[model samples]
Target: MNSDWLAGGRAELAAERILDAVRTVFIDHGVSGVGMTEVAEAAGCSRATLYRYFENRQALYVAFAGRETRALIERIWRDREVSVDRSPAQQLLDQLTAVLAEVRKTPHLAVWFEPANAGIVAQLANSPGVVDALAANFVARFRPGLSAPAAGRVGRWVVRAVVSLLTLPGSNEDEERAMLRTFVLPFVLDEHTVID
Candidate 1:
């Protein structure tokens, strides 16, 4: 019951509240439609308190996106572990399935898929740390011996294709995964025809 400890605890609580509010707002309104006032109302705190934690809407958006992306990477890593008995093809297929499932479940991810939110995504695209982290995660999961460039290109294609499928109207995840298996699994297992 020290006064300073109470003050710090209150501050931490407020920050968490604001972050949760921002996340909800982003999910409901996407990036362009959300504002500080709405975030403040969502957090049940004044605009001043919101500003204390986040400098501006863009900053909050970036922070929220970063948190969501980190969470996704963490979940994928947690759910997947390469085993000695599993073939590289099997590992890649498993990783793809898990990642697609995670993306479907994560709310904020829909914003990035929106055409109007392209600018926000472009900002993240330029971040070297994010790129490196993504590459490392892919390399670790697929354990592919391909050159970095080749891996990067193929990974991008697979991820985008998977995202396209998940975002489709009334798409069945299980069906899509099965379809992807027919296409992706074959390419990974055989070097005869790379997917063009």
Candidate 2:
């Protein structure tokens, strides 16, 4: 095999190994508690090798968030496609439930809320290329009257709210759903209250 091709294959494998390590670290230690040294040790690679793949801790966190975010968007899209007969509200509720549950379960999801991880949070807020694309597509389907930009903004807000709730210690599912209906959905919909 060509040397360039061999090197590229190895690089891809190394990247995967590092990402798997990142997942473990993020789960074991919250985003605020994890450091590059821990991630390197978890991956069984030197700090230099980890740095080559990720410039800094913030960059690694960004990659971690990006990976999980993509998986979530894909899941939502897949579920929606299968529910072709469902009403828009029902479809959206299903998608939101799945995505929110995953975010709550994923350790790195806290990255979005940690002030120290501002770099990662800025990436989500300022660029949000992946999140934006998913929002635009999904919003276009469910809320046709709203522009893509509006939907994207609402999507970001929902994500932020979810992160806030996830970071707290003891909010149950019923409480979360109530909070969503009371505090979140109404604000997005521009409603004064949750009628009935």
Candidate 3:
């Protein structure tokens, strides 16, 4: 979206344009490095206009993450194949790995997990907001029978695991997969094992 579209009665479009600009800026400068002023210039708008859309950098980050999470979920499920032959563990592996792969592949999203920026992510996640909602929604697809609260517990656990691996990966993808299979899968994939 071009800056010309940032006029009256187009608040949503203007916000999206700002976010698009932020994504580009994030690829060059890690999430922590991006500033509201830089985003304004990138979006071809004044700092006042940028602030009108997003009160602050944190607000912008939340909006971007919220928009992208829904889109990411769609992409993840679009490529997913459900087969009776596939074991539950394998399915969980595929789901988790797909998330890790997608996050790593997306420059804007990956920047959040960069070691220096991971702390910012952690700070945002401590509150029961986007992170909790994202994790719950992601896990609920696999454990549809679990209640909201139960799913939340499992989801928080999954987010922590993902963040840990993203910030400090194991030796390689193979090793990371092995660790997830051993430590993370059973609890999340096995309904018999209660998560309290």
Clashes of each: 0, 0, 0
Poorly placed runs, candidate 2 (over 4 Å): 1-8, 79-85, 106-130, 144-146, 169-171, 182-196
Once fitted onto the true fold, the runs of candidate 3 whose alpha carbons sit more than 4 angstroms away are 1-5
lDDT of 2 at 71: 78
Best by the TM-score measure: 3
lDDT of 3 by residue, 68-184 (tens): 876886788778877689887888788788888898898888888888897788866565666677688777777888889988988888888987888887888899899899998
Tens digits of per-residue lDDT, candidate 2, 1-196, equal 1224225557767777788888778667756678888988888887888899899876776666667777778876776574668655555556666667776565556444555655545555555564666655655565556766777776666666655565552366777676766676555555332222
> What TM-score do all the candidates reach, one by one?
0.62, 0.69, 0.88
> Where does candidate 1 clash, by residue pair?
none
Poorest lDDT segment (10 consecutive residues) of candidate 1: 1-10
Candidate 2 whole-model C-alpha lDDT, 0 to 1: 0.65
Between 1 and 2, whose TM-score is larger?
A: 2
Ten-residue segment with the worst summed lDDT in candidate 3? 1-10
Q: What is the C-alpha lDDT profile of model 1 across 9-33, one tens digit per residue?
A: 5875766667777778878888778
